[model samples]
Target: MEITAEEMKKSIEKIYERLDEVSPVDFDCGKLCGEVCCKDLEGEGELALYLLPGEELMYEESDEFELYYIDSSEIKYPHSWKGQIYLVKCVNPPRCDRSIRPIQCRTFPLIPHITKNGEFHLIFDETEFPYECPIVRDHIKLNHDFLKVTYEIWMKLITNPLVYDLIDMDSRMRDNRKTNYEIVV
Candidate 1:
């Protein structure tokens, strides 16, 4: 079943609200890594985060962030995805509107994973980044509420087939490559 744009907008709003209630750690995790995720540091490629299906509705063309649309065919996304995918880059590194951050920013350090047996889990994000995330590299113990809420949000997110296919595609690739990931939830 296809989701309408309005439905997708409402769902994204609810996700942001739910995620706002918890954080990965009691203190700002960025303090440990100097917010590297948001910065395009010297010698590293420009930092950008892709918006999930229909998530581009959350933002407008602004001075703080530059939004670029790429043809889905040009990228290695799931076959289920088509048309333009939105990628946003912060114009001013590590300083932007926090309340309206993308879901990817809201759920850093943990990524949704689905096993071959079809079990959904939240695992430490193993994607290679220009700079290491302290939470992942140090194996920091995340707040229980943060983990639980993030897991619940992901469970709801995958109900959208687009999101499901994305997670499934990544999970299958990981399984095929025998990539190591530490499951958190």
Candidate 2:
């Protein structure tokens, strides 16, 4: 089944509306120390890149960028899928799917998400993650401004039914639960 661009647009709108239902929460971290954490998800499936809704500027509007590829040679980390171990790889860094990207990467350290009821919530990025993402530390507060941007992307996907299916989640995010401070619930 092919999803039309029109359908995608409407789905996106519905997701955005849900954002308003989230309830905001308050918390603080003393200066997060790191550069940028893109892909340290040991079990979060293949490291994919997802494009935020309307944030087309991420790729289309950009003039400078390089694609990264998955190295098949790299042994799969000791992890299991269904009941077997598999080391997922990104073979095409040149063309990372904007949709298949890991949720962590899309949300960065912000990790904002909406529930089935259109409630917005904030999550904590894995402290154990070893990536040095600058964007992560650039803004850290209970008022997750950065998270909004990322959640907006997810909102578009869910509202638009971007995947049209749940897709493969190898327990996808096991302990990856956020504190779930409602923003608009």
Candidate 3:
């Protein structure tokens, strides 16, 4: 699955533009009153690691590893690979293929909200095994430069006009509307 240089460039450009949008905004990750969510069990399910469309193209082309999406549905990853992955370390996620990682990864630790008419907003989802995510806790401090940059990058990616275009394409592909268990890759 060789990728065209132009497409690769487009991916990098889009990602760079997005990276500049999601600035890491320092915020509190609520204490875990019970079991350590991410620590003990590095949560499974797509919601735990959703990847929007087109994000997989690069990964597929690169052949770094194989992890399929639930379907072409944007952001609806019902179940992703949950192999014996280690947690409890200062581990940065697998180095995302600069051109392949999903927009969600670009906007990590932050959730995207789109209105019915099609307006995007950046919202944080700190409900997961957050206590286990050091970045969500003391590791990433408020007003930190990196976090600020991440916050901005996420903001722009959500508000970027192209989001609608992507959504429109997704809608067309999703017309059939039947649940697809197999990922496109």
lDDT of 1 by residue, 28-93 (tens): 888998887888889887888889887787777467888889999998999889899898888888
Which candidate leads in TM-score?
1
Angstrom error of the Cα, residue 71, model 1: value is 0.7
Q: Give the higher-lDDT candidate: 1 or 2.
A: 1
Best-fitting candidate, scored by lDDT? 1
lDDT of 2: 0.38
Better of 1 and 2 by TM-score: 1
**Best-first order by TM-score:** 1, 3, 2
Model 2: how far is 83 from its true place, Å? 24
lDDT of 1 at 63: 72
Tens-place lDDT digits, model 2, residues 1-185:
97665675555445444443332224222124321233334565544343333322223322333323333235332222122222222344424443433333434454544445445454444344444533333433434444455556554454533231221121123224533232421
The candidate 2 region of ten consecutive residues with least summed lDDT is 162-171
